[model samples]
Target: MKDKKIERPIFPKKAIITAGMPYGNKDLHFGHVGGVFVHADTFARFLRDRIGNENVIFVSGTDCYGSPISASYLKLVEEGKYEGSIEEYVREYHEKQKEVLEKYEMSMNLYAASALDRAGEIHKGVSEEIFNKLYDNGYLAKASSPQFYDPDFKVFLNGRQVVGKCPIEGCSSDKGYADECDLGHQYMPDELIDPKSILSGKTPELRKVTNWYFKLEEYNNTLAERVDYLRANSNLRKNLLNTIEESLKPPVIFVKRKQLEGITDLEEKLPKHRTIDEPKKPSITFVFESLEDRDIARGVFDEVGVRFRTGKTLVPFRLSGNVEWGIPVPDKEELKALTFWVWPESLWAPISFTKTYLETIGKNPDQWTEWWHSEDSKVYQFIGEDNVYFYGIAEMAMFMALEGIKAGDKIDWDKINLPHLIANSHLLFMNKKASSSGAVKPPMARELLEYYTPEQLRMHFLSLGLSKGSVSFMPQVFMEEKDKQGPDTVLKDGNLLTNVFNRLVRSCFYTAQKHFNGTIPVGEISDSIMEESKEAILTYERHMYNHEFHSLIYVLDSYIRNMNKYWVNNMRVADTSDDNALRKQVLIDAFHAVRTVTTLIHPIAPKSCEKVREYLNVNENLWNWEYIFEPVYKFIVDQTMHKLKFLEPRVDFFEKHQSQISF
Candidate 1:
């Protein structure tokens, strides 16, 4: 019996791809590039080929309005390291970030910043628009919450201005800020343990402050349904799905067994809840049906002097804060003197960037709705694993709520066009998670180019399998003397392009130049070669659609290496016998393989692949998916008269850097 043919995954008619915005306070580190941007850009490029270039928009920006930026700027001012104002400081870093992304060959249509130039102005408008939509839909509520304030400094602290131990139960994050930790766990300000104000070097006190929040808890059921739909239909990462599921669980409070003993009337005094008392565990858990009940129970526990820590669950998503460096929140009645919180505002910054790019290109700014709101369109967000909670949960719930979809309302997933998240695990440095604020500092994205070409780094990063697990980047240039002599593990996948694939293409072109007067030899390609090329193309398309990038790399490696072996074996007979017909047949078959492999890898290493097209004398249409499966002769305008470009000696379609060649 014959095997059933595999079907290709369907792509959306239009797509918008966004990489998580990098903080504007500093230049991008390797994690920002390897873990997120490279993946996002590759997919965007593929979509342009699969769909049409006009139907795709790729965007990201600098997250400029956070307290982290303000805090970092203040420290620089105090140390006399920078003499510029806060705005100038972020602008400088924003430009530097854009420059570095360009150096890494990240092809963003617009890398706008939320606090710079026309993008900033558009972001302010977008912020107010989303805020008003949520308010009109009754999704927003103003809550009076305790915000961290330092008595010594006589000022309220936000975000990085205050540091503390994370109070979230079981979180191992090393650094906790005012509301969220470095690992992206969110908690109420009052729940942070041993809070200290960075401005005063003293313990901070909680002061009542009013801010706007999206009632995220109200959409618990809606988000659950969305998760179920994605789990069933889409290829979401399991870790990301588990993280979102954990967030959707009923709220729970953990209290020590000893504290529960002292408060004998706790059950009578608290809101309705179930107590899970385990003899083996040190703490008693109180689970509530709703976030409101959990908060009431928490207050009662506080009044009864019971020490408790909150568990991971949905809470009201804060939308505004008192940070002066942020986008000004619109004046809504007496709710004044506030700014949009960095996270919430950053979520919508891509929309602003889309509008800015459209306007810049002489298109209607409102055309962005066609890409964002239409059922024919899809948005793919590439983010790190730590951010799954925000991008997967909070952002989805807010987008739905803004469209007037309430908790119990039946959702039409088709009309909503919610974003599809692609989350990646951490890109570790030397087997340890590295960040700018962490103990092990990460290498900046630009510094990597000194030892490796952008194409080499791009190939290596795409093969890391970050979608499955944390992968360490072990560049030999940064290794100790004892580990620097051998081949770097990071270069293994890249060598498939710079070494194996390079030799294959060079051999094909040089042989054609040597034997056939620099013109592609005319003959029929063998059925065996055609079947192999088709199988590789189909497998590659499937992997690309599922975002199994590492698997796609393996397919390319095997197919290209096999094609090269076929060339060496067949060319030996043709060269020995001096048979013109057999030589032409070999060139015809080999050149067809070259065309197919080059097009398949165009998205991964665009610059080098485009050089192949230049040497082949083909137009940009060579990359269009419509002609992706066709033979090379189909693209030749006049088979008999066509003359190929001459191949110069030692020219490489893909080249390693001079320094890397020695290594």
Candidate 2:
């Protein structure tokens, strides 16, 4: 396979971090935090730890284009300067996100996007280049089409910006964008009655307009193959695979062209009616009754592999010249009419910023090529379910094309080497509370980070994630559920961070106090704690590698709890006078176990882990697995007894009670 593993990278070992493009239209909620940024941050930190920092690079940015942005731009135009322009608007949000994440102690190598560099040329150039390619390939069309034109506003209401009557049977809320109805019925534009532009407040005029499209339908087969590839390889969640399969299946265009009455030819004025059209040059062309009927006609043509009699190829229309708002056609206007074109997929601004940082620091642009182009790069994009279309499909198509692979066409489906990894998370509802309006559940990353330590939050989510497709924000459920039963458990309110912190403190305290007291001499870690420590370290390595974060969380918690348990159970009953050295060795063993657990947990919470490293007087570098075990063993054997205090684990019952009741 072209994508078969390469010799594991020897230099700048390829790792790429992509946070899903955030639309600048609305303020971000918590689910956004958990799904994209938090996940991306985790992976970045993991890779950074796996390979030295110089080799791993993280990239993320904001999306600031297309209809959503244009609408916002127009809205701002009316108000004479938006609090921020579209570019500025997206930049602000990305900055706010960075601020929040930094508070949580996220560090990334690159944050690339427009704010970091005037990407106007890159954006325009990429879109133009794509358009030129499709156009030259005969995938563009210049036919006049009836779009919802708002004459009052002197602009077209791109399908998304229009809102109207609720379409679900007996429902009363507005049918805005056609993503989904409150009743869960996916609706089309025609389904909306009394449809009006949110901008002009006027009934739209169905006016003939010209636009571009990236013959997505042309790539149906390739897309299906990709989906099958993902399904076969289990590259995506099962539900996500199903969604792509359903969406990428050839768009069944049943709409047919309406036949005209008493009209035909270029010389005659076009039909006054907006919905109908006549062929300017005709003979071989026959008009069908309606778009749906025309689709039936097209299907027949497709089945038979119809060829044009006029020697003009019927290139599948891929790109469009839609001028409502977007990157403009960089080519000559006359040539554009004859070409199929599409704007390049936009990335968020922070990613562009990161790109600039890379360049400014004297890193060659080719540094990015290693990750973007290499088969071994193993690109994983973390995003929410809402963004599957763009991130999952559209972006993949662009990259495939750039890599000289033809998407949507058949060669060998199995041979098509696209990005090997795609990790998408679903919405994490705020609290355990379900809302009546069916509003998306918010994420808990930001809020949880405020009160609890980051390690707790990371473990909580990882435990919750546990290889499942959907994760809920039922913090209480996460907190209470455990893989093992114990009377004195450590996890609390899905907030087990403090528990980890206390365990570290106790481990250090026990190790030091034993040395000072001249109790059981600290000779070597007892076989019991050593075995347990190995299990904890091994469990972390296995779960994290498999992306089984949630499962790892349970094991990690159990490891800490058991280590503490080992001490409580043994220390109270030990014969301290008989072999003072051996008695202290037990405490030393417990400390060693704590050290291993804390180091393993560091990927989730670096600062807390650092504190543990600092107190032990161990260099931070020893936290890596290759050293953690050996050092712990050495430390166990080297110590006499040490001075420290083992504080009882604190459970904030008042806070736990309030959290339980909040939902």
Candidate 3:
């Protein structure tokens, strides 16, 4: 321990952190902030300090265009609820989302909108670049797929305008639209159950429309290989890995046993396949080796009038639609009228936002390659569980495809650059699944700010254990009058700062001022204290490397409370014996613990930690990992000249929200 032989965790030299973009059609709900952005911010801030701040760039934006926004805008305009052009309406929410992020101290390098002003112009260029690269690499295909057409409205419906039961087997999604469900399950448009156009409130007919698609289905084997690569190379979340592997399955169709009863010739009529007919199960599964064979079987099934549902698997990822509000798809193969689909273009929006941020800072836009493609860099994308399909699978396949990676091609670990996805489970509202479109609507992100401080909410969100499973955001303030009687669970973690840690820090400062004329004695940290501090630092580092945030608060809780208890118990003994020597040693050991705690918690509660640093009268070197294990005297270049700032009586650095303060 004297020579410091312990190995430390290595972080990437340059990193990019991205949180999922909020759609421009609505203000951010609580899940957007508590479930994703706070977690993303904590890691980004840590990377900024672990490496240099300049090496980390965190960016996300308003997903400004798509069918959802179009549907929302038209509904509002017709209801006389809004009086503005679509651009103006989207901009309104974009500004609001930015404000909410700022109030919460998100620490984003840039928050640009996909379809607004300079960022929009840059995004359009980036989208075109991606499409051209994929086209030249032979991954783009123009296919005429069945689209929902509303006869009453005399128009083809966008994906979100059609609502039906999900066609993916084993999915319990509340609602499904065109080719995907609200829970991010993707399937064929033709397989949707009882489809109805929201435009006319009537059944829609299937109309063949030509649009561009990424050959996602053909890359099933290639994606399977990528899954193998990730399993060996990454420490990703179990749910995220399982979600991706689920989609790597081959094409499958399930038929209810009751519906196929007495149809003895069903197997002979369909294409060649393998059947798993378990008598105890309600349905029979038919698995095909390829999509072409499955499509043939599908036609035969429809001819015989047998009902079926598809299992979750990779399908042709549609890249273009006729939605006018979206960024225009690069006109290729004489297809001039299509626009990029919201899901595909938004996948690359982070790249566009990166370029825009670099340009605004007067750096070359192409410098994005260093952060995006270099071996020394890593991209960490944080998203909710519902988006694992889009971020973990679709985006990853498209990224590899853009790099000329195709089926059967070898992936060189040194050459290929793919993001490390961090998808958290749903953050429920009072233990119930909540969505803006659902019966239990989620509270807006800003609404919670009314009752709690931003730091309080940030601390609580980080401790919710969302990495392991879905967690309820049941703030007692939001509960019914009869149910609001217990000690508020939301305040449990924040009190470590506002009550315990705050008192210990104040005790150290006040004690130093009264006993040593405000100058802490220059001495070595006690061996016990140094050993414990090193252990805490290493544990915190490992948890961060794994992105296990809930465990971090657990570490802080123990370390902070122990330091407080040590001060309380020892100080009483020192006061009885009038032992100044023992008192000074206790102060020295406690201050070292204070420094380590302050540095470790900086990521989760940044503003308050900075205040803690200011009172210590130390420079930014206090946060440098090089001196992370050093005692307080190392930060003070002139120990004799340094005097800690005097703490005013009853002043708290980490204060409770005004609403939490009682008279």
Q: Which stretches of model 3 miss by more than 4 angstroms?
A: 1-6
> Which tens-of-lDDT digit does each residue in 277-365 have in candidate 1?
89999998999998889989888988877788999888899999998899999889699989999999988889999999999999999
Candidate 2 local lDDT, 291-364, one digit each (tens):
33434444454444442111111123334435444555645455343222212345323334444556667876
lDDT per residue for candidate 3 within 441-528, as digits (tens), equals 9999999899888888999999999999999999988888998866898899999999999998898999899898997777878888
* C-alpha lDDT values of all predictions: 0.88, 0.52, 0.90
State every prediction's TM-score relative to the real structure: 0.97, 0.72, 0.98
When summed lDDT is taken over every stretch of 10 residues in candidate 3, the lowest stretch is: 406-415
Pick by lDDT: which candidate is best? Answer: 3
Q: What are the RMSDs of all candidates, in order? A: 1.7, 10.0, 1.4
lDDT of 3 at 10: 82
Best by TM-score: 3
Report lDDT (Cα) of residue 190, candidate 1: 86
